[model samples]
Target: MKNIAIMGGTFNPIHIGHLIAAQCTSDHHLFDEIWFMPSGNPPHKEDEVIIDSAHRMEMCRLATKDHPTFRISDYELNRKGKVYSVDTFAMLQKEFPDNKYWLIIGTDSLFNLEEWYNHKKLLKIGAFVIVHRSGYDEEKSLEQQARLRECYNTSFMNVHMPQIEVSSTIIRQRVAEGKPINYYVPDAVSDYIHKHNLYQLGDDHEIR
Candidate 1:
């Protein structure tokens, strides 16, 4: 079975750090292809800010265009309504039964995995590849680790790359302040944002 990695996120503006992480994972992990799935709508707190779904998908496409092994999937966008990890994984499992999907998530996300809708069911649909992130708790008792090992077939991928402190929220803030966001984001994305006049205001704006 072909091993595919699915990296799902809002991707307000895809940056080098994201690209580097995906590249490293694809190379080191020997993944057949890495699909960058942009979430249409996440079930975050009502106060949380999320950009438009279309823009986020476009940004993902532009950011991953150079890499042949990297592809952008608008699966969540086309699904409509609140996107849940369980539903997405279920759909993918049905369509590509011959392929083994590795849902890529950061260590930060793992801490809150239990909060996700039908998280346990989602875990059964496919294996997860959790990327190690800074300040993420690495300590785990043998008993707890054994319990997790028995609970799900998950893999921990230690991504030893430069930790980029910049986040989508920070990028948006910089844009609102008229600060340069060139290096943090891809040139194509930076140009797209300027050309399309995206995320210029402090308001929740997403450039797909």
Candidate 2:
């Protein structure tokens, strides 16, 4: 069975930090491929305005174009209602029964696993690879991993990743302030954002 890593997110704007974390995980675990699955309508972001799926998906494509093992999936984008990773993973497992799936989540989300819809079943879908997110306590993350392992009887591995302080929110704020996002995101992504005028005006306005 091919080992695949699923990186699910809203990706309001694909940034360097997202790529780095996925790269680090891919290198550490030798995943066959890393699928950047953009959530269409995340339950958590229901109250927040999300950019058009076409733009987000295109931005993801531009951001990971250089990586041969990286791919973008529209599975969640085509789904109806509020999107949840648990349902995504479950469907993926059924569709690709021969493949071993690994869910990639940041340390921040690691702590909030229980808050997810049917999180336990999601955990049962496959192994989880936890990557470090900037500004989170490493010790606490390790402790949480241990707790999860004991509670769920599943394998949870951590990847050693270089911390990037940049985030989608930061990039959006910078663009709103007419600042450069040169290093914050891939050049293609930066140009695309500028061309499409995305993430400006504090994410309150989404490009159609």
Candidate 3:
């Protein structure tokens, strides 16, 4: 069976940090492929003004185009309303029974894993891999990893990612302030943002 990993996010604008983390995890695990799944208007992010789903999807395509193993999946987008992780992974197992699936997330996401919609069922549905983020505390991440393992009786793999201090929130802020985002995102994605004038609305309204 091929080892496949799913990296799901809002990906309002796919950035280098995200790319590095995904690539690092793929290399470390020798996974057959990494699927970057961009969500529709998730309930948690509905308060913010998200760009058109097409734009988000296109940016994801541009960002991962060069990596042969990196792929973009529109499975969640095909469905209406909130598409929870549990539902997505459950479908993956049903449809792609021969392949092993892993969910990739960052240290920042680890802290809030239990709060996700039907998170317990989500944990049980597939394996998970956690990568490092720039500003999060590593010890705290390890502690949370231990806590989740004990609480859910599930295991998580860890990947060492470079400390790239970039985020979709920060990138959007820079664009709104008329600053350059040359290295924050892929050249194609950067050009797409300028050509389309996305995220100029304002700063991030992400819930803490």
Give lDDT per model, in order.
0.74, 0.84, 0.84
Judged by lDDT against the true structure, how good is candidate 2? 0.84
Q: Which residue pairs come into collision in candidate 3?
A: none
**lDDT tens digits, residue span 29-123, model 1:** 57889999877777773454666777777888888888879988888888777888888878887997888788877766666666789877875
| TM-score (all chains, Cα) for each model | 0.87, 0.90, 0.88
Kindly report which residue pairs in candidate 2 clash with one another: none
Show where candidate 3 strays beyond 4 Å: 134-140, 202-208
Q: Weakest 10 consecutive residues, lDDT, candidate 2? A: 199-208
Better of 1 and 3 by TM-score: 3
Candidate 2 at residue 71, lDDT?
93
C-alpha lDDT (0 to 100) for residue 68 of candidate 2:
84
Error of 3 at 192 (Å): 1.1
